[model samples]
Target: MVDPAQILASIKTHPPSCLQATKCSSHYFSVLSGSAKHYMMFSEKICWIGFCLVGSLTHVFATRYESGVLELGIHSLVPGHSITVDDDFVICDVDIEVSFSHGYSSPGDLDVGITFDADSPVTTGLARNHSCGLFGPVHARFDDSSSNTLAVNSNTCVSDGSDVKPDGDLSLFNGHSSQGSWTLSFNPSRGYIQLQQWAVILTPCDDGAGTGDPHFKTWAGKWYDFHGACDLVFLSNPSFAHGTGLDIHIRTKARYQYSFIESAAVRIGEDILEVGEYGGYLVNGISNADLEKLDKYTVTHEKINSKQDVFTIELGAGKQIVVQSFKDLVSVKTVGASLEEYGGSMGLLGEFGSGKWLSRNGTVMSDAIAFGNEWQVLEVEPKLFQTNQFPQHPVQCTMPSTSNVGRRRLGESIAEASAEKVCGHWGDLKDQCVYDVMATGDLELAQAGAF
Candidate 1:
């Protein structure tokens, strides 16, 4: 029921926020294709590496999204491209594109949905269907305008990882398919690593009824699926424990039924664009599927002509999968300044365990959500910061700074469009743990540098 396009559109034409995530996405440890959307760190990719968890902090621009409660901001995080956070639910905001494809296929034909589970674990989890993380697009073979030829009965979901292609049909387990090929491309703007693996018609032997030929199938039907996209970023070092772990078996276990992809990178000559942030975690998931291979390491790296290595797959029915597991201890944090006051009053800003609820300097404030449920940190408009134009911190004037000063409410209707806005309380502040949406249900209420 989630609309991936709506999510992407929000990122393309929406405002920014002043909220923060307290913890990484929750990790649903296991190995299987997922429904998309796990908590931030526990989202997906890192789940493939050891514990894909980051320690100390999980720094985002510090924004939160809620239905009628808050708006998710999508900015030109990358040049030439705009991105949005998918907030079909709590936590995650993986990027996704719709009615979009690799000129070969699309995923819109399938009932795929993107979700936001900002908090997942680094270890075990369940299979995800029609969900997104970081950057995503549910791929299926129901060709719209993009596909020029009818290739086969298959799904072609794609996203961030641009250059996609299966190594080949031959591997350690099942024999290679006689039909179907792979493709690739890149969408640097959305942090998308576009990849497309193409094949046509089911090769099922029908209980060994006859030789499997995609051209003429007897009992099975032909499906032309397209929309393979999005990238699953794996840690540079999987052996080294970090973030949440992903079980690869579930992916290959189902074989042909699904495809599990690891991380990929984009290189404009020498500059490398990592799909996910430098230090993010992957949520736990089942790599459950029939994969003739598992490719690890720099699927795409600085090396221009470097060919990726796909892992071996062992398939067939009644095959129990023993997967590689992981856990995420990764944490993200935001960088900010503090807000001193005109009075140079008692220290400004509150202190949390490792984070701060207080403003950093004369015009800056910071907020964090800790490691559980989401909490909004209201950020006032920069125009509000203009009030801070007062040559000092806590500006306490018997008179309002100016008529414009009143427009600086963190959650004010006028202030929701700026990049650097205020959130939460400013200077001297006190609050309680929040279990529900704010009275206004608007994230702007959490603005910084406010009294």
Candidate 2:
């Protein structure tokens, strides 16, 4: 939204000025041919105000001595500015005033006509002439009693001697190149017509001729999980708002029986969190309480390419979430989970159906006790996880206690057995041995064996 106050301020700071002007014969004159051209400049390709044309005239020289003329012609060299002949130029809101000084002797025989050049492009290459009767020659007698006003292209002329018409069109001169030539020509019969005065207004187009502010680009489509394991799909339509700002909407659904979970979470600039259906927990200076206070997250900036965007997720608190986006994937670097939170002997663990974990500093843990057996602890440098770089495999690690650990996949019972052994090392610690069995019915317990 544009601030009206700002617009007013801009107007006050830089007032509008005439970009160009050209005038010929403001005083009454008798001439065979006359034309005026003006050059204009628009600061912006798309300007608010273009230009205007103003002039006035009156018909004369049709008395007993001089003898009335056949017709008077007015033409505009510009594609759309002809009054005498019908052309591509569309003219409206005519307010020309006409009056008779002397009475007419033969109003019907002596016709007063207005015509334009037939070569105008607006005529579609066809020269069409249009004329209307001004007054009857019989009623030509008038001193100061005969005067009239008519709108441009108005079929109805004022019956009263004096009148004025206010509505009309002048679009031809409104929205062309900011810098161009505009010429208006007038020809009168026997030097009888007199131009009084005229004025017109024009407005520019909205798009600013490709230089408008608040430019936008949009992308809308569907994406699928890389593995195709769970029929997981994402329908997203994201619109760019004011360069860095963004509005994103994504609908995620799972078609298969597998539970879909996110390994990371998105943060909406210290104000919101758009948690998916499967709720998760925040970490690293962010707490569940902080997440509760936040409004539903609406994206302000979308991650594009590998460029990292760090957003403050807790207003004023300074907590941030770093994110990177790829073709169909997003990598969030916040300490958060995309699944149910569970406390373990090492730290906390949030598990996804893809056997991935969101853990604190590589301290391995699992939502299910038996599930621990499926993963092997690996010793690698502690670096940020790149969603596109790593292979789809299970991994676990115990930090501080050891710098390097090798991972080995084992069977369900083998994992249970190993867990029991590790629990035994704690020497009858109740919580150490008694693990939470949160697995669903289908994964409760199958044939327990060694891997």
Best by TM-score: 2
The C-alpha RMSD of each candidate to the native structure, in angstroms, is 31.9, 27.6
**Model 1: how far residue 178 lies from native, Å:** 16
* Candidate 2, poorest ten consecutive residues by summed lDDT: 208-217
Candidate 1 lDDT for residue 344: 17
How accurate locally, in lDDT, is each candidate?
0.20, 0.23
Candidate 2 local lDDT, residue 255: 18
TM-score to true structure, per model: 0.15, 0.19
Model 1 clash tally, residue pairs = 171
Model 2, range 299-321, lDDT digits (tens) per residue? 23332223222223432322233
Error of 2 at 374 (Å): 54
List, residue by residue over 1-451, the lDDT tens digit for candidate 1: 3343454455347533323232222221211123332221122111111111121123222234567554333322211111122322111111222222222223222222222112321111111121223333334332112322222234333343332222121111111211221111122222122221211111211110000000011111111111111111111111211322211100001112211111222121222222211222121222223222223222211211112111111222221111111111011111111111001111111221111123323232332212100111113211111012221212221112234333434333333323123333332222210100121233432331110
